[model samples]
Target: MKSPIAIRRGAVAAVFIDLQEEHRQDQRYLVDGYEKILANVQRLQAAARASGVPLHHWAYIVDLGAQDRPFHPVEADGKSAFSDKDDPLTAICHEVAPADGEALRIKAEASAFRSGPAAGELKARGIEWLVVAGVWTEACIDATVRDAVASGFRVLLVKDACGSGSAAMHQTAILNLANRLYGGAVTDTDGACRLLSGESVTVWQVEGSVPLRFTYENAARLYAEL
Candidate 1:
C-alpha cells in the first residue's frame, strides 16, 4: 500500500477531545483544561495557518468512541480537572475539512496509531514525517510518539504547541520523550516551524525543546498575514 507523502507542513493539530461539564468532576477533566487548552490550540492553528500551512492537512486525533481514556487531560491552570462542552478532536478535523484527496485519522485511544485507523491511513499515504502538536503531552503525545517511531515515521514533537497536566508534567514528558523516544528531536511550535520550513523561529530554544526560555517577540508580526 502507499504511504503519506513527505511534507514539512503536513497533517498536524491540537489533537484532543472537547471538554464538557461532565469531563470534569469525573476522570475526563484530568485531560480537559477548558479555555487554556482551546486558547493554546487556537494560537497554534493561527500560527500554522498564517505560515501558509494548510489546516486541513493538519490531522486532529479525536476520541469518537472514548467511553474511557488512557491519557492525560489538564486544565489551563495546569490542573487535571475536566470541564463542560469538551469538543471532540474530530470536530477540529472537520473544521478544516480536507479535500477528498487528502487523508485523516480517527482514534479512540491515547496514541493516534496505538489502536485505530491512523496506522493504516499513515501507511497508505507513505507518511515519512509527522509534525505532531497537541495537548496532554504526557499521555497521548507520549503514546503517539512511541507508536509513530515503531512504525518507522520521523516524529517531530511540537513542545509549545503541546501542554500537559502541569508544568512539571509537561517538562518531564518533553525530556523523557526527546531523550528516549525522539533522541532529542523535540522542539517548540516555533522551532518546529523553523525546522519544518527553515524560516523564522519564534519560541526560545532550550536544548532544542519547548518550555522555551526565549521567544521571537515579533513572531506573530513576522508572519502577520502568513
Candidate 2:
C-alpha cells in the first residue's frame, strides 16, 4: 500500500537536474516526450516559486580539457558526447530556466551531491524533503535520487517531469528507484505540486523489501500503477 506524505512549506525544496538544451535539442540525447517533460517541470517551478519552496537547478557540463571518465561516451570525432562548459548546448532550457537569485549549479558527475556542496547546502537551509525532476531518468536522475536518500533526505520524485531516451528506459529506471526508495516517495507532477504547496498527498512508497520484482512482462503493468 502507498502512504500519505505531508510536506511543510519551509522544510521542503525543489531540485531540477540536468534540464539542459543538450537533452532537448540534441538529436542524440533527446528524450522521449521531451516537450511534455519540460512542461511538467515548468509547472513544478511555478508551483515552487508560488509556494515559497526554494528551487535549485543543476546542469551537467564536462570540462573542456579535463580527462574524461573511463566510461564516458565519445563520438567518432573523439569529442565528448556530452556538452562542455563552453558549449552553448550546456545552457538550461529556457522554459524552465532558473529565475534571478536562483542558483544554477554545474556538476561534473552524474550525481549532483558527488562533486558539489548541494547536500550540505540543502541541509544548512533545513530542507528535509526534495522535489526532484529532470532528464535521463536511468542515469543522472537515478544516481541523484539514490544519493539523496542515502544522504538522509526524503525525495518526492516527480515521475512525469522526468524522461529518458525511451519510454521503457524511463519507466524501468523509475521502478528500480521505487523499489529501493526508502523514506522517499514517488509522485507525478500533480501530486508533487500539491505537496509543494503544503498539502497532504497520497504517494507511492515502498512498503517492503523488493516489493516490485520487475520483469519484462510485468513492466507495463507496474509502470501504469506508478
Candidate 3:
C-alpha cells in the first residue's frame, strides 16, 4: 500500500457516509449514535471543499434498499439487533451539491470497497489511499477499511467522525484494529488530515487521546498461527 505524504489541492479526498432518518432508525438502533457523527462529517466536508476537492470526492449516503423496508429497532441484547431498510442510514447523508462529473455510488452492502463503483472509481483515478468516516465504527466503517486494504488501498480511520451505539464499542473497535489485527490503523479526524498533509506525525501529541501504537511484536503475536 502507498502512503499519502501530503494532500495536494485536489489529490486526496475524504469520504463520509452519513446515516439519516430511516437508515439510522434501522438496525434496531444498534448503531444508535448517528447524531454523534454528523458534526465531524460536516467538518470534514468543509475541509474537503476548502481543499478544493469535488463533491463526489466526499460523502455518500447508503440508499440501496431504500423505499423497501425501514430499519427498525429490535430487543436483542447485543448491539446488532437493529434492522435498517436503508431508512435511518441514508436519512442523514450530507447536504451538498455535485455536478455530473462527480460520482455518488449506492450499493447493496455496507462496505463501498466491496462493490458498487467505489473501487473501480478509485482505481481508475489512481487513488490508492482512503480516509474513512461514518457511524458504526466497528461495523460498516470497520468492514470497509478491511476490504479497502485487501483491495490494495490504504485506510485511515477517522475516530471522531465514527460512532457506535456506545463508547465501549467505539473504543473497542479502535483497539481491535491497530496494526495488530486488521492491518489497519486509527487516528482522529484532524490528525489524519495533518498526516496526509505531510505534517509527519503518527498519533496526536495530546495527553488523554494518544492513539495506541501496535508494535511489530504485538502484531506478530496477535496474528501468530492461531
Candidate 4:
C-alpha cells in the first residue's frame, strides 16, 4: 500500500451520485443502511463546502419514452422501475439535495460522465482529484469511479458514503474496484472529509498486483476491514 498523500482543497471536487428518493422511498431499490449512507454523504458535502471544494451532484433520471436498453426494468404502467424522470420519487432526497448555485446533473446512463460536461468542466478548472460518494456501490458508483479514473482524475472513493442492495454487494463491489483502482484510494467518510479539508491521511490504496487476493473464504474478513 502507498503512503497517505495530501489532497489540496483547490485540486479536489466532491461528486455525489444518485442520492434520490427512489432509492430511499421505494422498497424495490432501497439500499442497506440508506440513512447512514446519506448522513455520511451530508458530512462530506459540508466538509467540501467549508473547505472550498466544488460539489457536483448527479441524479439518475430515466426517460420512459426513450429506447429501452437491454433488460430495462419497467412497471406495468410503462414507468421506469427506478427513477423515472416524471415521477416524484425521482427527486433528490431532501437531506442531501443540492443547494442554491449547485447544479444537479441529470443522467440517463449508469456513468454520470457519459452525458455531461462534468469531466471537461472539472479539467478546465484544473481539478486533479475527485472525492466520490453515493448509492448503488455495485452499479452507478462503480461505473462513475471507473470513468473518473479513465478521464485522468484520481478518485477518493468514500466507501461508507456509498450503498447498494446489501452489505455483501457493496463490499464485493468495493473489492473489485479497489483491486484495479490504479490512481484511486478507498476511504470511509471520515478520511474523505479530512482529505477534502487538505489534511494528509493514510488510506487504503492498491499496491502490488492482486493486493486483495479476494476469495469466497476470506470475503467476510476483507469486508470487515473495509
Identify the candidate with maximal lDDT: 2
| Native-to-model Cα distance after best TM-score fit, residue 34 in candidate 3, in Å | 3.8
Task: Give all candidates' CA lDDT scores.
Answer: 0.49, 0.89, 0.54, 0.88
Per-residue alpha-carbon lDDT of candidate 2 for residues 146-193, written as tens digits (9 for 90 to 100)? 999989999888999999999899999999999998888998999998
Model 1: lDDT equals 0.49
Q: What local lDDT score does residue 5 receive in model 3, on the 0 to 100 scale?
A: 39
The stretch of ten residues in a row with the least summed lDDT in candidate 1 is 16-25
After superposition, which runs of candidate 1 have C-alpha atoms over 4 Å from their true positions? Answer: 1-40, 47-106, 198-226
Q: Candidate 2 has what TM-score?
A: 0.96
| Model 3 residue 204 CA deviation in Å | 7.6
Q: State the lDDT of candidate 1 residue by residue for 1-226, as single tens digits.
A: 1112223445432233222222223454344343454454455555555555543232333332344444557457543333212444224323333345434444445677777665566657555666666656777678877888887776656665566666566666665566554322555555555544535343321243333222245333322211
What TM-score, to 2 decimals, does candidate 1 have?
A: 0.54
Give one digit per residue, the lDDT tens place, for model 4 in 1-226: 7468788757899999999988877888888999999999999999999997889999898886885676789889977787887889888899899988899998888998865788999999999999999889999999999999999999988889999998889889989888888888988888888888888998888888878888878876785575
Clashes of each: 30, 0, 23, 0
Off by over 4 Å in 3: 1-11, 22-27, 30-33, 54-89, 93-102, 180-185, 195-200, 204-226
How do the residues 59-122 of candidate 3 rate in per-residue lDDT, one tens digit apiece?
Answer: 3343323534356333353222333333244434544323356565554456767766667766
Q: What is the C-alpha RMSD of each candidate to the true structure, in Å?
A: 9.9, 1.3, 8.1, 1.3
Q: How big is the RMSD of model 2? A: 1.3
Per-residue error at 220 for model 4, in Å? Answer: 3.3
Clashes of 4: 0
